[model samples]
Target: MIDWNSIAKKFKEADAILIGASNGLSITEGLHLFADNAAFERLFGDFKRKYGLGCILQGMMAGWPSEEEKWAFWTRLIHHYCGQYQPTPVMNDLKAIVGEKDYFVVTSNGEGHFELCGFDPTKIYEIEGNWFTMQCARPCHDTLYSSLEVAEKLSAAEQGGHVPTELVPRCPKCGGPMDIHMGAGQRMIPDTAAQARFQNFLKTYHGKKLVVLELGIGWHNQLIKAPMMRLVASEPNATYVTINLGEIYIADNIKEKSFGLDGRLDELLPALREACEA
Candidate 1:
């Protein structure tokens, strides 16, 4: 019962767009972190058999006996999910919706899809970091090392669920283990430059006709969702459009200016693109 035409009109009239996304958006892009479905089984069946880990997230958090084994798992994950990722239809639809509008993307997803989809890298902030980079486990410094080459090499060298001991990535400074630059407690190096860029984006669009387009953000996500809602509440001209799988929510204060489209993103995004063109 959502009005796609009305939502498209809002998108068209907006002076700037602010996008907020989370794990649900990643799911729409065929990267389900929590599900142990056919895709997960196909990609990670060996890990499940070896470690009894249920899903991608479990494999990410599971303790391994050695750094070799750990890197073996990480390399496979990075190789498949990051190195081999191609932009999906959902991403293309989103691009059509945004069109030529000035936009900034703030996402908790670490999968690096926004960059892969041809979005402006400087305008996208990955709050949980991304799969394409790694940092020292002890975080000896703030430097983030590119893991693309490392992942490829390790993935090729991996044998019997373990990479060669010499092939494991070690910090150049501390010689400690390296971990993917993600949400790994205090050890994770923060993306201060990206954070600054996002803050600047907010400042630039403060009182403009901003469209806060939230996609697949769950209720528990205070990191991205809460701040977006707050922006909508403060900016009188801001229009809030949220699309999710179920139980779409609009803040009571901004309900009058909000549109909630609840459905699968794969279906909704293409329909929305059609509506926008119409």
Candidate 2:
């Protein structure tokens, strides 16, 4: 059972908060990347029929027949997930709980929801680069460009499962095709500035009453989850609180200070928010 009162008291006492989120959190916001659900079919039926793609992740990683088709697929995703997104109840509750506290977020999600929901963008470290930005596919330069306007136009102009050849994004200097500034590896530009800021946040809060609030992170995500657990173990004053649906893990070392709540976020967050309010 969740000890709501104890968790509330911990939040009340925290001097700073660091949030770690990944795929599961995005699922709560109704964007399931791994599922070939009805919504996926509705939004991506053409791609499904042509390429036999199962889910969004497959579409992202698939090799397209041409630049026009690739841009068409990407623009549709950007227009729907980024351009039309609104802050959900979970985000609202999280914001309320963080309320003026010194806080930072590290997320593997590239959807940009934290920034859209009024969290200071500088404080969010998108470990995987976000969809709102695009970079040169050849990466001949370091600059990233905004993609929403272009995506909206391209999405509207898509025909026969492909964007117009003229609408395909290209780098200004190199004239090479552009790709989303996400984890496309060598083709993608890294958000180094954000990484520096996240490190600085950790340095500033070294041994204070820090609360590492982990949401929807899976067991295998060593990039965010493993480091967070290490931090909590190393910092005596740091407490770890994790919430996920059907999975909650607390390492033995941090078990005394860790609180793991396993359940659906839509229901859990509101209750936690009320407890924090109390």
Worst 10 residues of 2 by lDDT: 181-190
Which segments of model 1 are wrong by more than 4 Å? none
Candidate 2 local lDDT, 1-278, one digit each (tens)? 78899999988999999999999899999999999999899999989999999999998888788999888888888889888888999999999999889999999999899999999999999988998888888788999999888999998899888998888999999999888888376567778999999999999999899999999998777989999999999999999999998878888999999999898888998999999999
Q: Candidate 1's residue-wise lDDT over 10-104, tens digit each?
A: 88888999999998889988889999999888887888898898999887877778889788888888889888888899999999989999999
Q: Largest TM-score belongs to which candidate?
A: 2
Error of 2 at 96 (Å): 1.0
Sum up the clashes in candidate 2.
0
Model 1: worst 10 consecutive residues (lDDT sum): 180-189
Against the reference, the lDDT scores of all candidates come to 0.88, 0.91
Q: At residue 37, what lDDT does model 2 achieve?
A: 98
